[model samples]
Target: MMKAKQRIIILLLAGLLVLTAASCSSQKAADPATETLKLGVLSLEDILPMVVANEKGYFAEEGLTVELIPFQSTVESQSAIQSGDIDGMMNDMVVAALLKESGTDLKVTSVTLEATDERRRFAIVVSPDSDIKTVADLKGRELGISFNSIIEYTTDEMLVAAGVSPEEVNKTAIPKIPVRLEMLINNNIEAANLPDPLITFAEFNGCKTIIDDRGRSIS
Candidate 1:
């Protein structure tokens, strides 16, 4: 098995082939500007390889131009791709399925982050004053999540993996990460599903982590 960093580098280079494939479409002139690949991305660890490649002139050396467009959310990222404002964007399997279901032609070029014992990507957390001390305690309470998103999937996965059946769970569509975090911290929502940084912050703020996807890669 390749190390995590090595796998990321290889996958990122592999992803550039998508740009090359698109470069052949409807172009009459050799315009360097038009040939530039536009990739819509969120500010995540996955963007690191693209940043390094751009900064070190790797794309230019390889006769390719790349533009990395930052997006605030997946909704915006998908909107950019669908409107042709961007050629591609970093996305997950859940979003890919949703895109296909919506009739969008999508291709998954690479896997940026993989599951590892040291990496805790997401968690189901409860409010500081919440009576929910475990995933089983979440049966009748609301779990905040962004609707039809990875967060929602993570919540469901966390529940099922922890032996809580779908009929025993309750989900509330909070739709925004910041809002979800705030609601969970302030006791507005009994529990909320979130990724790291926010998950660590919630722990620091006295919110309890009922479970997290660390070893079990359910998401």
Candidate 2:
């Protein structure tokens, strides 16, 4: 079995390969008449650059027409890409891998964000009143996550890093981040992994953080 860090690196490299190949293929097949490219985005701070570029008419300045398509979650964005509704989206390396494995012609051309000790972006959290204070306490408990996506991948890795086997925890698919956050706040699940903005929001509202991707990088 691959070590946790190795697995993360391999997955990211695979994403880069898929992304580079897709970009080349698309460029070769591009039509000058249709200059518009539709890209999917979520309501996360990580997508702020694209938003600013669009709002500031950067694409227009380059004689390019770019459409910023908004989706409620990564799962929705992936569906849009798979169905040809959108050409691509800003997503995690893990999501890129999952898309490719499911036969979606996609690529990850950039690393917009990286988790670090000084800039933690994702975390495993619990209700403020829950007694699950440590990673080991998560054993045999159900973790709310969007299954098969980046959230699940990070949660597993963080658990392993904390000396807890991933097999010891159960993952429940709660597709929407808002719904997952709500459930977590209501104590409907023992724990949940969330990304920033929501992670910050949850902490402010009294959720206790168990562990985070501090000092870690997905790529």
| Model 2 Cα lDDT, one tens digit per residue, 81-121 | 77777776767777788778877766567666667668877
Model 2 spans > 4 angstroms off: 1-35
User: How does model 1 fare in lDDT?
Assistant: 0.74
Across 1-219, the per-residue lDDT of candidate 1 in tens digits comes to 236545545758653322111333545656674587788876555677788777777667667898988775667777777777887787666777787788777666666565468887788999999988889998878888776777777778878888998567778877656777888888888898877778888899989999998887765
In the predicted model 1, the residue pairs found to clash are none
- What TM-score would each prediction reach against the true structure? 0.76, 0.80
Task: Report lDDT (CA) for all predictions.
Answer: 0.74, 0.75
What does the lDDT read for residue 96 in candidate 1?
A: 72
* Runs with alpha carbons beyond 4 Å of true place in candidate 1: 1-11, 14-30, 33-36, 55-65
Alpha carbon deviation, residue 149, candidate 1 (Å):
2.9
Q: After superposition, how far is residue 195 of candidate 2 from its true place, in Å?
A: 0.8
Highest lDDT against the true fold, candidate: 2
